[model samples]
Target: MKNRIQKLTAIKNAKKVDAFLITSLASLKYLSGYFFYFEHGLSPFQLLPAALVVGVEQQASLVLADNETQQLAFIDPSISVKTYESYVYQKPIDHTTQFLLQLGEAFKQAGIKSGRLGVELNALPASLAFFLTAQYPAIELVDISAEIAHLRIIKDEDEIASIRRAANLSDIGQAAVLRLAKTGMSELELFNLVRREIEESVGTRVPLMADFVSGTATATGGGLPTSKIINDGDLILTDFTPCLNGYWGDSCSTIVMGTPTMEQRSVFNLVKEALEIGIHSIQPGVQAREVDFAMRQHLQAKGNFGHHGGHGVGVIYHEEPRITPYNTMALQPGMVIALEPAVYSADYGIRLEHLVAVTNDGCEVLTKFNHCFQQGI
Candidate 1:
């Protein structure tokens, strides 16, 4: 937590920001180590579930609803917690007025009268922006959401541990799905099997999402599981998501319902090779685009392949430092990345993904799962 604070301070200082108003929930947690579920009526946006105001001088305060304040205390005890009453409750205090008063008090206490105030415009609502500008007309509001996100791109030891556990659970769910996959199994059945296995294995209600599609549907790559049944020679693509400890581990594997055709095997081999190339490119000081290029070049050398290669995985499934041709962010040690290489065609599609930890010399694969395309019982 101390290191997180220091990293934020460094970002603030580098941007010459006096204070940063963080609205993104992940950013809030990264800074204050607090977690709160977003209430729809209060804050519907995932990006700005709650607001966190942190000053360059080491002052930090969190603005949340009354119901969430106590929950946040369990995770972060140092942050000054201020809560506003719920809008549905009819009491002496009203929700809007309570939030306004709390924000005013927090601003005043932080001595943020007139200076360069940074806010995550991408995450913040326009109405909130107008209200803040109206309240503090003298302060200069600046958008520094990218700076805060870049700071969180690198994972710490604890974060890596949490993601590793998530990956392990995801592998378990994938194995369950594999066992249920057969020539006549419905996509929905496979989905429920994996979901039930994850819940029973963890002994808790875990957030699980998976896409089990067959034949032509497989080309779509990702979608909610349906009742579509598998057929012999049909390709099955399953992308697994098992959320644990407020983080997510995402992995996708392509399998054949029965025996694979020669063409299908060729496509799967190419995708697997592309994934390997991308994984080999993970190391400190390597440009993010270099990995994307490596994978794309592999596919282009064979033929045109569909979809972007992969992306960063953390609190949200798709975070920063996206693996695409457009992004030039350099790979750094301590960054957790998901390498997914996929190919789509009219008849079938195949994708193989693995969660990797970027290290100083090379990369470490965090997810443990067999990539075989054999049919399951």
Candidate 2:
């Protein structure tokens, strides 16, 4: 978390900004080192609008609603916490006005009165951005979105540990479904059951879902679970991503309802091979696209491939250094990635995904689930 603040300061120094604001919830949580969502069930997209502000010579500050003042004080008593007029009592327009007014004051308190300031323009609301410029004509607001992305790409040790914990929780959920999901159960039932199991397994509640699919629908990246029932000779694909302590863990596996047809087995084999090929290409300094091309070539030659070979997974489910034909960023140690090489067809699809970390000479798989058709436990 200190590195997060230090990185933003480094960016501020490089850009010659006296102060910077962090609007993205992910960035705030990363820097604040507090799990804001653990006790609150709200999604980040609809969170209690909050921001973290830092100045060159001042302590970091938190801007949020007044009602959350006590909680934030209890969590971070030392840092400055500024709050707007109560949003609960004010009209929507007034709320926005007061919020912006308070935000402007926070900027001033951070010593941005007549200096360049940085904000995550892409993530900050357009109207709010306009209000900021209008109210603080003395401060130059620059978009530091790229710098924020760069800062988040390479995870620190704490982040890596949280991601691993999230992954373990995800595996617990998927394993429950695989072991107990029977032919007669509906898709939604399996999802609900596994979700409960995941919730019970974690020390803190984490968001969980199963891309539960069977029969023909498993051929694609399935959506939410439905009423469809598992049947004989059908394959079930379950991909679960559980968010824990602000970090997400991803895991996917294909389970058999009965015996797989020879042709179906062939498709699974090829997909497994593609995943292996993609993983084999991962190492410090390897080009991202090179790994993607190596795996995609196998599926492309055989036909019916969709989706990127892999993507970075950390505070956000999908991040940079994407393993795609268009990205050329070199892999670096400390990056945790999910390599998912899938094959989609008209009838159904088979794919495999596992989380891994880029190491000095190679990549280490973070998840250990039963991907074996005959011996998976």
lDDT of 2 by residue, 1-377 (tens): 34367667768777777787778767777776544554455433322467777876746788776656545633345457777765453444355666677777776777766678788886687787777678778778888878788878888877888888888877787678767788888988888888888888875456765588888998777778889988877778888888876788988877777777787788788889888888888989888999999988888856747678888998788898898889989899989999888887778778788898887889778887757542233
Candidate 1, residue 25: the lDDT equals 64
Looking at candidate 1, the ten consecutive residues that score lowest on lDDT are: 38-47
Best by TM-score: 1
Between which residue pairs do clashes occur in model 2?
Answer: 218-349, 219-348, 219-349
Write the residue-wise lDDT of candidate 1 on 136-186 in tens digits. 887888888778777778898878887898898878877876687776778
User: Number of clashing pairs, model 2?
Assistant: 3
Query: Global lDDT for candidate 2?
Result: 0.76
Assess candidate 2 and give its TM-score to the true structure: 0.89
Instruction: Give candidate 2's error at residue 160 in angstroms.
Output: 0.5
Alpha-carbon lDDT, every model: 0.76, 0.76
The TM-score of candidate 1 is: 0.89
Q: What's the C-alpha lDDT at position 179 in model 2? A: 74
